[model samples]
Target: MDELTLRIYPSVRAAAPDLETPGLAGYAFARHAWLQAWADTFGAQAHIEPAIVVMAGVRIQMVLPLGITRRNGLRTLEFLGGIVTDYNAPAIDPDFARSLDATAVQALWRRITAALPSHDVVCLTRMPVTLDPPEGAVGERVPNPLALLPGVNAAGQARSVTFPDRYEALTGTLRPRFWADTQRCRRRLAEVGPIAFVVADDDAGMRALIVSLKRMKSRRWRETHSKDWFAVPAFSDFYDAMARIDLPEGRIHGSSLNVSGTAVAAHLGLVYRSRFYLLLIGWEADGWRRFSTGRLMTETLLRQAFDEGLRVFDFTVGEEAYKDDWANALMPLVRYDEAITARGRFATVLMTARDRLRARATQVAWLRRIVRWLAGRPLA
Candidate 1:
C-alpha cells in the first residue's frame, strides 16, 4: 500500500479548499450548507468540531464533521447532526471510492482513526453503503463501499424514490395497490376543496412553513410518546437558517399542499444537484387525518419534482411504512462504533447489548410496550 498524507482541519471554515472537492461536491453531505449551519447553531453546547480529512494536499478522501461531548464521564465522539442527519459517511471521491479494496480501505481507516482528539468511543451513524447516482444517470454509483469499514447494519435503513422522466411512467412502475391507493388519496383530497401545490417564493414564506411543520410534528410526537426533536431551540434555529440559504446549485426548498385557501401540509427539504432530499414534513392536525394529507402532499410533491426534472426524491433515513410504499429503491445505511480506550471498550459492550435488545424489542409488541413504559415515570 502507498503511503497517503492526511490533513485535519479544526472546523469547516478551516477546510475551505477541500470542501471544494470536484466530482463529489454534488452529493457530499459535508459540503452542504445545512452542515455549516448545524455547526454554528449547535456549536457551543455540543462542542461540535469539523474533523474534515483531506488526502495528498488536494484530494478529499473523507470528511467527518464531528462533535465531542461527555457521556457518563467518558468523552464520546459522534456525527455533528446527531440523529437528524440521514447519511453520515466520509465523502470520498467516487472514482477513488470504487478503486478501494479491503487492504486499502483498512489502511484508510487507520489514518482516520489515529487523528481523533482523545475520545473514548466514536459513533458515526447512518453511514450510507453506496454513493451511486440513479441508473443511466450522469453521476457515479457507489455500492456501499463504506460498509467495508468496521460497522453493523443499523436497525433502520434509508429510503428514496427514483423518478422517471414523466409522472405517468413513475406511477405506472409502482405496485398496483400503491398506485391505486395514491390515486384514491388525491381524488378524495381534491373533493374537499380546490387543491393547490405551492413552493416557497421567498424567505418569509419558507420560515412560515417550517414553523407550521414544527407544530405539526410536536402534536404527532405527543401521540406516539416520542421526544420532539425540533423542540430544541438550536435544532429548530439551524433548520430555519438552512431554509434561507441561497445558492446557485442548491438551497433549502419549502413547499405546501393547500386545500382551498388553507395549508393542510408543509414540507421543507434540500434541493441539490438534480435530487430532492425530503427532510421535514407535517400536516395540520385538526380533522385532516381522514384526508391522509401527508401522503397526498408527498404524491403532489413527487409529481411537481418529476415535472421539474429532478431525478431522485430521497426520503432520507428511516424504515417507515409510507416510505416503503412510495420509494422504488432502498438505500442501506449502517452504523460504525469503535473504542480507543478501556472506558470506550466498556461503553461499546453496553451499547452493543442495548442495540441487540432494541432490535428484539421491535419484534415483540409486549416488549415494545414494556420499553416505552420504562421510559416514563410511574406516578406523581
Candidate 2:
C-alpha cells in the first residue's frame, strides 16, 4: 500500500479543484460549492479548514470539510457545514472505502487527526453507514469509509424515501393512508383555489423564496420556543449565496406550492447525484394550515422527484413525526466526539450532561410547555 499524504487547506475554495472530483456517493452537501458558500459567508467566525488525503501525494483520496469554533472556552473542531449540512462525512472513492482494512483505515484516520490544528475536541456528526453506488444495481448498499472510525449513534436518525424508476411505480409504494391523505389534502387545497407547484428557475425568484422560507422558519421556531438558526446572519447569507450558484454535480432548487396564485408552502432543496436533499421548508401562516400545505408540498415534490427519475428523496437529519410518516427507511448517522486534551475531556463531560438534561426536558410535555412559556412563546 502506498503511503497516504494528508494536506490541510485554509478554506473550501482553496480545495475546490480537488473537491470537484466526485467520490463514493457524490454527496452534494460535502461538495466544494456547498461548503465553499458556507466558508465564504461564515468561515471567518468559524475558522474553516478543509483537509484532503491523497495517495502518493497525487490522486485524491478523501476530503474532510472541517472548521474550528470556540464554545464554553473550549476550542472545538467540527465539520464546516455545522448542523445545516445533514451528513458530516469525507468524500472517498467507493472502491477504496470498501476495500480498506481496519488497520489501514485507522492509520489514515490517525494521520488526518494528527494534521488537525490545536483544538480541545473534534466533533463530527451525521456520518452515514451505507452509501449507494452510481453504477450498481438499484437499492444496492456499499460500506462507507467514515464508519471505520469509532463513533456513537447520533441523537436523531436520518430518514429518506427511495423511489422507483417511474412515477406511477413510485406512487404505488406509498402507504394507503398516506396516499389517501395526500389526495384529500390536494382536494381541499384545490377547493380554496387552484394549487400549483412552481420551481424557482431564476436567481431572483430563488433568492426571494429563500428569504420567505427563513421568515416562515423563524415564525415556527418562535412558536415552539426553539432557537432560530436562520436568525444568524451567516446562515442566512450562506443559503442566499447558494441559491444563486449552480454546481456541476448539483444545484440549489426552490419549489413552492401556490394556492389561488399565492405561495402557500415552499422548500429550498438540493439536487445532486439523482437525489433530492430537502434542506429548508416553510408554509404560509394563513388559512393553509387546515389544508396541510406543507404535506401537500412534500407530496408534490416527491411526484416531481419521481418524474425526474431521482432515486432518493432525503429528509435529512430529524426525528419529526411527519418524517416518520413519510419515510420508508431510517438511516442511522453516527457522531464523533473525541477529546484531544485535558480541557477537552472536561468540556466533553459537561456537554454530555447538558445534552442529557435537554433531551429529558424535551421528553416531558409539561416541562417543554413551561420552557416555551418562559421563553415568551405563545401557546394556544
Candidate 3:
C-alpha cells in the first residue's frame, strides 16, 4: 500500500509530463492532443481543462485522463470525451494494472471522490460494464449504473453485420432490400448528373466541406435555439487542429458524395487506430433527397474501410433510426458516478425518468412520427 502515491492535477498539460503516453493519436477526436490543438486553433474558445487520476511509486506511472469543474462552488468530475469521444476510460500504467485488482481500483475512485467537494456531479458515461475494480477496493464509491435503455431494442448482440474474417460477410450482408433501393436511387441520381467520391487532401478542401457540414447541421439547430458545441470557439479550434496534426492523428478525412459536380452529401471522419471514427455529417440542400446520399455515402465509407482492412467502424453515439438500421446492433451504455450526493441523486432521477420514457417510446412508431411532424421542418 505504501508503494503507491496519488496525485490529481488541474490541467492535462501538467498532469503526466514525463509518463510514457500514447501521444494523442489514439483518441482522434477527443484525445488530449486534440484538446490542445483545439485550444491553439480557437485560442481560448475550446475547453482544454483536463485532470488526471494518477498513481506513482518510485516514479510517476499510471494515469486516468479526466475533466473536472466546480459549478457554483460545488466540485464535480466529468469524463473529458463528453459527446466527442467514444471508447473512453482511464489510460492505466501497464505495470499499475499488474499491481492492482478491481477492488484497489475501486478504492482509487473512493479516494479521489473524498478529495473533491466543490463539484457536485460525479458524472460518468459510456463505461463498459466489464471494467474491473482495483485491489483492496470495493468500488463502493461508484453509483449504480443503469442500462441506457431497457429491452426496447433487445434480443441481439452487437456483432458485425459481416464477419471479422472476410469483408464480404459484412458488406454483402447489408439489408438486401435496402441495397436494391440504393442501387435504384444511385442510378436515378447518376442520370441527373455526375456522382463522385470527392477527396479533399488539404486544409482548404477540408475547410470547405466542414463549412458545408456546419452550415447544414446548424440550420436545424438554430430553429430549435440550440447549437452543437463545435459552433463555439473552443470546439471549432479542436476541429481545425484535427486538420493540422499529421496523418493517423490530426488529419481530417473529409469527402463529399456529389452529383453533377455539386456536393450532395459529406462524410466527415478522423483517422486513428487504422479505423475511421464517423463524426459530423451533412447532405446537400434540396438536391435529390430521394437518393438518401447520407445512407449511400455511409455504405461507401464502410465498404472502403473493409477493403482497407480496418477492423472497426464506429457510428458513434445516439439512437437515430438510420443508425439502428445500418449498424450491426445496439450496444448497451452505462452512466456512472463515484460520489453522488443529494442534488446529484435528484438529477439522476430526472435523467433516468427521461431515458426510460425515451426507451419506451422507441418501441412505438407513433411517438417518433409525432416528433417528426412537430419538427415538421425538413432535415437541415
RMSD of each: 4.0, 4.8, 8.2
- Candidate 2 lDDT, 1-380, residue by residue in tens: 44666677776777788777744454777777887777778775665554444342356766667767776677778877875677877676666666777677777778777777788887777778776664343545666766777655555578998876566666677788888988898888788888788899987778778877888888888888999888898877888888876676667789788877788889998888777888888887766688888888888888788778787899988777888777877888777778989988987786776556557778898767655554532211
Candidates' C-alpha lDDT: 0.72, 0.75, 0.58
Give the TM-score comparing model 2 with the true structure, all chains together: 0.87
Identify the runs in model 3 with alpha carbons over 4 angstroms from their true place: 16-20, 23-30, 37-49, 56-61, 93-101, 114-118, 129-163, 220-237, 246-251, 338-380
* Residue 338's lDDT in candidate 2: 85
Best candidate, TM-score: 2
Candidate 2 root-mean-square deviation in Å: 4.8
| Tens-digit lDDT string for candidate 1 (157-274) | 7788888766788788779987787678778888889999888888778777887888888888887898887888877777777777654466677999998978999998877777
Q: Model 1: number of clashes? A: 4
Q: How accurate is candidate 3 locally (lDDT)?
A: 0.58
Predicted structure 3, TM vs. truth: 0.72
Summed over model 2, clashes come to: 0
How well is each residue in 1-380 modelled by candidate 3, as lDDT tens digits? 44677777666456535323542112343345654553355424334355666667765545556666554333467665554555445544434544555566566666766654345567666654322232233332222112221211222222123226686676566788877897788788888888888878887888888787777666646755877665676566566666565542335578888777788888677756544667777775465578888777877777777776665666766545676556774444466654367765566565566556567677889876655564534222
- Say which prediction, candidate 1 or candidate 2, comes out ahead on lDDT: 2
Span of ten consecutive residues with least summed lDDT in model 3: 143-152
